[model samples]
Target: MYRAHSTVATPSWFSIIAALVAVMLWSAAPLLAALAHTSSPLQLTALTLLAGALATLPLSRSVPMARLSKGWQASVWLGIPLLIFGAVSSYFVGMRLAPAAEAALITYTWPVVFVLLSQWSRLRTLRLSGVIGALIAFSGAALLLLPQALNDGLGGAANGYALALLAACCWALYSWLGQTAPVALTPLLPRLLLVACAIAAAASLLVEGSPKALSSEALLAGIALGLGPYGIAMVAWDKALRLGQASIVGSLAYGVPILAAALLVVAGMSVLDWRLPCAAILVVVGCCSAGRRDG
Candidate 1:
């Protein structure tokens, strides 16, 4: 049975660094979306995946291919690849279709999803605080969607919000499934990413044909996303989670929406909407509450 506990021996400094890395990785989504304005979402996704795979290639060299291949079987290669492809594709498409801030807000709902799923599976007992927090968090999510719901309805930004939620669900499912995988994730990640890259490439070719010429800025942004958020950041995040208190690291995840929204505003991609701050506060508080340890 799963039991909740914190690693008291883990240094605070390392946890802080890991938390910072996670914040950066989370914020990278909207930034990547902003940078992808000139390119097809599919193509951009493909390029970023390819770049991530290439960046991580050296790290995977020492990992035995046979062992890695065995891990793929554990993940049920078909399901894992499909999940990653769906998650990335939906996220990119949602970003393309809606405001970066809104998309980021929607995608950041995965923590709530995780909590709910764990409670549902009896992996963790839901405390009163968790229930209340889930309600507050979901309320914030609803508030974020209100603008689109009122204005364009399902025909416009609603579609993007829906897609973002879909992306969140896919991510949550993948995370849950990863827990039961036969092989540990650290060694499995590089290979999993390679499969994701292949899926993205195939999808891009089918939808967008050959990759077209991109502006210097877009190219740089894509490269940054590949190497930073999708590549090195992932490795750091995994290490941090493994070494740090899960609750503390999970609480830090709530920072993503705020960071992403602020960055988008600074980039002039989004206005400082009143709803954003209010929703962010609620979401962060809710997530923190949900992650609290039961006495």
Candidate 2:
């Protein structure tokens, strides 16, 4: 949920290249899902967790995840499910409620959530610039949500937005809890447990209460969920976030919507739209301002 900033202080040639690569993938995540037609968040979540769990086998067995502290073990068990469910449920649900652009934009509110929570918890003092950035970002997010809000007259797409907001809440909580967790920056066992729980949850939800059978497309999409955001993305992000500024990571995360829009166009699922790119610019600006305040 919290993508960390690039932490290579000296900025070697490799670090510079890695930073660029990270930004590109980070930006592209939401678009990747839209392009993939990642419809069922639950299925996507389950597969991600399963994949993460599978990834854990070699590392856990070799490194012996058991060697970690009890506190870390508990954190992993708690945080992993939070990651899977929070991501899967909210992302898919938001996609259903609104356009991918809108969902992605809405979800970026996690930064604001983090800032607020930090202030409340005495982790940091809230600043005027941060408040202003939040307001501007909220206004821009509101504009994107306007269509969904209007569409509520037909169905409760507005309610879908609410659900999406709820998903954001889960993400915020996940990030915050993870910060306090006692494991190393990258904890394979805890991450594995979280993914395993998510996989079980996703499997149960997808397989049960069925009228239609599982489509091959959906199955593949679930695998993408497991592999993409849930698998590699988490590891990369955790490693980075552990070493960098959460605000910067949160801001950079907004790039996902724009990336998703571009990918959607390439896939011919959607047309090129200008609003999301514009919103992304605003998100980046806000993130920069917030990062400055924190720095």
Candidate 3:
């Protein structure tokens, strides 16, 4: 049976901190998209993962070689590397093809996907509120995609939207598998990240050849993404999940699109679109409603 077990009692403060970390992690989307303008998506993914792997080397060292080897072994058996590669690659591709804000909003549907998958797998049960909330949130997602569909008819931004949805599904599966895997993720994360980096690098080489020299802005942004969102943020998220209820953590994910949008606007990467606010409101409300305790 797939069950989530927290090593420590969850505190409201800790949950709040975890939620904030999640927001920060996702807020990197627009910045990453902006960097994609100067670098290929595959190259950017490779560089970011490589940076994250290097940053986490110290932690990896603390884990015994035997355990690390087991982690690598588990990654292959469990297909973690492929899952991470697909999710990250698709996300970057989608961001490159569409507005960062739209991609973020679409990918943020992972929580809902996670909940639904858990229920379908019999790992968890959803309350009536959860069902209602899922419907509402999904409706909001449709609203966000509807404009693109109407404008381009599956020829333009629709591809990006499809990729974003694929990314979301992949992410949901990854999270679920991580929770249920026999191997502990703390020891496995570094190995999995390194593997993902290798995959990204190979894909980049195949698709883009040797990367061209990047602009100063692109270089700095890539480094920041590696150290911040792809690196420390991941560590923080894992810690939080280990210490908190997965449900609460998942619920808090509704804040991601909002944070991502705000960050994009502040960075001057996106303009305020009326649809965004409306979609944000609907999604937030639906997700929050789904989280309500019925008992």
Candidate 4:
């Protein structure tokens, strides 16, 4: 009995903890960018991906470059499109319509998609508690994002919200693909993927006529976003997933939004009225309690 329990609990706990740390760091990306006063979210995302991809170079020994497959070559190359559409486009377009909190709520809905995919794939069964938890989380999300929905003129905000949610769906696809694909490419894959993404982004900037519009500050912020949050946080996320199952990791990923919110409050970017705290608490409870029935 001791052995049985230990085997299961240990991996779950470890994955959860690792994911918690990863998300916390990952959550800081936007706040730091906001604090840095970045001019363009698209450019920042490009730089972030570039930095993240570059960081993997030194860690090449962990995922040796030689072991990668021909198919993986395509997969590695394909990440450019994902980064551009998912990270760059989503960041710029989503931020325009939705504030960070609203965008994050929609984006983080990947967990629900994850859950549904797991059930559909027969990877795992979903519990009623998890479903209820999702609804509760959604409720908190609505409160967090739609406070002025009626009066604020949903025009672009609604579009942004939809785009962000779509981006989250893309993220779910990314996660799902990971389960099937072994992390066979070296650490270089991520960095290389970023380079690919950068190329794509460069093409985008040229086409969009953003070069003249790009300021020195925006460039720096882009580098920071690429290197710090995009690059470093991804390493953290990779470590977390390397430790164990997706479910536990996804659960712990909930910590990101909370941390982001706290940072927003500290920066005075958002209000900490009674509803905010209450909503945050409810979100925490719902997410943390989703699986506690078995615990």
| Alpha-carbon lDDT, every model | 0.72, 0.58, 0.71, 0.59
Q: Is candidate 1 or candidate 4 better by TM-score?
A: 1
Clashes of each: 0, 5, 0, 6
Question: How many pairs in model 2 have backbone atoms within 3 A of each other, for residues 3 or more apart or on separate chains, i.e. clashes?
Answer: 5
What does candidate 2 score on TM? 0.76
Best by lDDT: 1
RMSD of 1: 3.7
lDDT for residue 159 in candidate 4, whole number 0-100: 81
Lowest summed lDDT over 10 consecutive residues: which window, candidate 3?
A: 1-10
What lDDT score goes with residue 69 in model 2?
Answer: 88
Ranking by lDDT: 1, 3, 4, 2
* lDDT for each residue of candidate 3 in 216-246, tens digit (9 for 90 to 100): 7777777777777767777667666667776
Pick the winner on TM-score between candidates 2 and 3.
3
Those runs of model 1 whose alpha carbons end farther than 4 Å from true positions after fitting are: 1-8, 58-76, 123-128, 151-154, 293-295
- Give me candidate 4's TM-score against the actual structure: 0.75
Which candidate order results from sorting by TM-score in descending order?
1, 3, 2, 4
Each prediction's TM-score against the native? 0.86, 0.76, 0.84, 0.75
lDDT of 3 at 29: 56
lDDT of 4 by residue, 55-123 (tens): 555555455435778776566557534643574557556766666655655565555554456445763
